[model samples]
Target: MNRNTFVPVNEPLLKGNEEKYLLECIRTGWISSEGPFIKQFEEQLAARVGRKYGVAVSNGSVALDASVAALGIGAGDEVILPAFTIISCAAAIVRSGAVPVVVDCDPVTWNMDVAQVEARITPRTKAIMVVHIFGLPVDMKPMLALAHRYGLKVIEDAAEMHGQTYAGKPCGSFGDISTFSFYPNKHITTGEGGMIMTDDPALAEKCRSLRNLCFKPEQRFVHDELGWNFRMTNMQAALGVAQLEQLDKFVQIKRRMGARYTSLLAGIPGIQLPLPRTDFADNIYWVYGLVLADSVPFDAKEAMTRLAKLGIGTRPYFWPMHEQPVFRKMGLFAGESYPVAERIARRGFYVPSGLALTDGQMEQVAEAMRKVFQ
Candidate 1:
């Protein structure tokens, strides 16, 4: 093995019509938010996800913020979410003047424990924020049932789940308002962008209004409500349009990468690989993660340090929301403990699993892992 060969944690593949669309944008001077690619990208993504409308936003985080506000969930409302997800989930709720009620995740899937959600629900619970963690979809059948029974809204965060499905239904199709991210590391990259999907025309309109500063169509300068300037630029949409065209191919490549890594790293001691498939959906290998066994002498930070010295890039798992200092200082999740989330946060980290990763690079990563654990 070449000790100097470096493998990054993720890299975007842009072999499609990205250049053509971007050049078109430049040629036509449709470079701002008013470009044609914006609508084209939004409509195409909405159709692919089985939704009636899509609102392109600046990025995924604001997409959540817009979705929360559009749903009319504000002060005194409670949104149930997982403790194992990114801070963006809780941040949106907190920013909206709503309380985020968190539930523990399943140890195996690392998705919100649907079983635990029911126990945490109170009279103020207004919505269930279902985030599809990693590549696996949260068991949505039961989640949908719970939402139906409780009369609570569902906000699906399918940020890492492009072209993935749950129980044969599209992931973005499950929630009343679903959101997606097009960050460079996602299955499809648009540099930095996001989309909000919904079947209700009214909700779709609200998302659009919210993203563009709540400007009235009839009177551009007049604003009746406060909203953020979260519109996705035409240049970003050009990338999205081209990238969306290659989604099916990208998904296939991701699954193959995951399969190859699993085959290569299969019996390595002291590490737990991702569950390849759930009952409802196969793992998309958004990023190939590994959790150290309890017997391992070191935690994920040390593991990452070792891998970095070996010229392999890795990233630690999300720190559980309850343990975050910002939340603690805000008097949230006081005295809470989620053992599974805590353990994973300390023990889990993902290796190189980019769309642009070659088979040879993956083999090198596997060799690096062998060296690290030996």
Candidate 2:
């Protein structure tokens, strides 16, 4: 296949009112942060997740930061999270002057290991940041139970998961705070945007303040405390509202893509495909990840490089946070080792599983995989 035909790892499917809403924003001159679309998007997104309130933000990372800040977790505090996630989770805790105590992920679910969470809890533990990895919800019942028992907050990073549920409940419904991203590669695209959701009114107000730079109504620009400029634009929210209207359909397409990839690559030795459904919820196929068996000749990096050469886009899994140079320089998790995370980081890579991917493209991707293996 020609390199021009390369299939991307993930692409947003804009099959709804994106253009229509964007045009409306332009017509009304409400392209910036001020517009009705912002409130509309927030209300719909929060309601979709069964939450009472939502705070729109500039991006997913800052949403996490604001949530941690709103909970009053700071200096001398600790926030436990999965070691095999995007650095945003840890960055938030660290930015708030809290220690990020990382844990290993469950090998099967590729989510934070609940059992390890309690073992890492300390007297100064403030919260457990639960990031739903690759469109699957964390097994939240146990995690929530543990949090309640110890009076710890749960911050749900539902960035990669949309329209996914656990035991028939929405993914974002259980946490003290839940966050979402609307990057182009996510289930929905707003170019770049995110949301923070919660049932707690006080927490919601705090997050809202934190997102808007803590502006006081009585005296504008006279702030009691400092907050970052993390407000989402009305244009982005317009795109999000349009995308949200079609999110359920997008999720169905994602599952189909996963199933197709699984069937097409079934007998490829030394490569493991994602499960269609786990005990918690059906896999939304955020990415059709392939994990090489121990017998494989090369690790995920090498495999991804070869796949790229064959016009197939592949992304390696998150490198274990404990092994990150930046974290090591901070003298955190210095002697700690997460064996499962280390192994997965070495072996895992995801192939094309975009929302806009066609059956033919997936076939090409599978064929390219076979060529690489051969």
Candidate 3:
């Protein structure tokens, strides 16, 4: 591989449409958060997710925070979430002035362990934030049942699962509030943008107000409650609208690349490939992940470093949030053991799987992995 030609772990799938939409926004002088693109993008996303409303925001983290706030989750509340996820999940809870109860992930799906979730629910438990990590949907049937039993709100972090489905229902449609990220590396890109989807009209209004510093209609200059300036710009929304138009096509490419990776890596010893769910038909893979079995000579970090040396960029699975220094110091987590999350963090790594990657590049990645493991 030439040093000049770098195969990134993931890349944005942008075309001329994105540039054209942005230029239109600039020409219309609607470059700020308030513009036609914002409403159009929100409506289009809501329709895609089978939801009634969608509120665009600055980014996914703020979307999560706004969702929590919209649902009246605040001090002394506990939000259950998988420990094996991006740090933003826990951070969002903390930022909302609530305690995050970190649960272990299911070994099979690497999503929040439903069994652990039941055991973790307390009187203070206000909600459950399910992160569909790497585009694999959590078994929502059982999770939703549990939430209903306990009267806890459900927030779906569909950041990595733009077009995925669970039990025939869309990934973002199940929860009380669902959040998505539009970072460059996600299934879609808007430079930096996010959205909150909900069927409840009241919650939708609250989200809109919260994202704009909780402005009041009665008093023009008066603030009803404390909120942040977490608003998405029209420029970003314009890009998002354009990207949303190509989402299905991009998802198709991702599915094809993921299948190719599995076909090439499945039979390799010491490699445990990601398993597709039988019940779910649509899985928009954000990354092609694999785990090193216990018998493997090296851990995830070692394998990633070796692959990197071969010009194949790879990434380790997320570190369990309960063990992170900040969360541990806060004394938020109760249980001492989260074996599944810890083990996955140590053994798992992901190869490049992006719409931007060619089949030939995937072959190169697979060949590099074979060389490392052989």
RMSD of candidates 1 onward, in order = 1.3, 1.1, 1.5
Stretches off by above 4 angstroms in model 1 are 1-4
The candidate 2 region of ten consecutive residues with least summed lDDT is 1-10
Tens-place lDDT per residue, model 1, 1-374, is 46448888888999999999999999999999999999999999999999999999999999999999999999999999999999999999999999999988888888889999999889999999999998899999999999999999999999999999998898899979999999999987789999999999999999999998999999997999999999999999999999999999999999999999999999899999999998899999899989999999999999999988888999999999999999999999999999999999999999988899999999989898999897
Q: List the residue pairs that clash in candidate 3.
A: none
TM for every model, in the order presented, reads 0.98, 0.98, 0.96
Kindly indicate the candidate among 2 and 3 with the higher TM-score.
Answer: 2
> Each model's C-alpha lDDT?
0.94, 0.89, 0.87
Our model 3 lands, by Cα RMSD against the true structure, at 1.5
How far in Å is the alpha carbon of 93 misplaced in model 1? 0.2
Best by lDDT: 1
The better-scoring model by lDDT among 1 and 2 is 1
lDDT (tens digit, per residue) of candidate 3 on 1-374:
77545578887788749989988988999999888999999999999999999999999988988998899888999999998999988898898799888888888778887788998899999999999988688888889999999999999999988878887788899879999999888888888889999999999999999998888977766896988899999999999988989988988888888788888876678988877655765556788888889999789999998988889888889998978888777876645778999999999989987679988888888888899998
Give, for candidate 3, the lowest lDDT window spanning 10 residues: 275-284
Model 3 alpha-carbon drift over 4 Å, by segment: 1-4
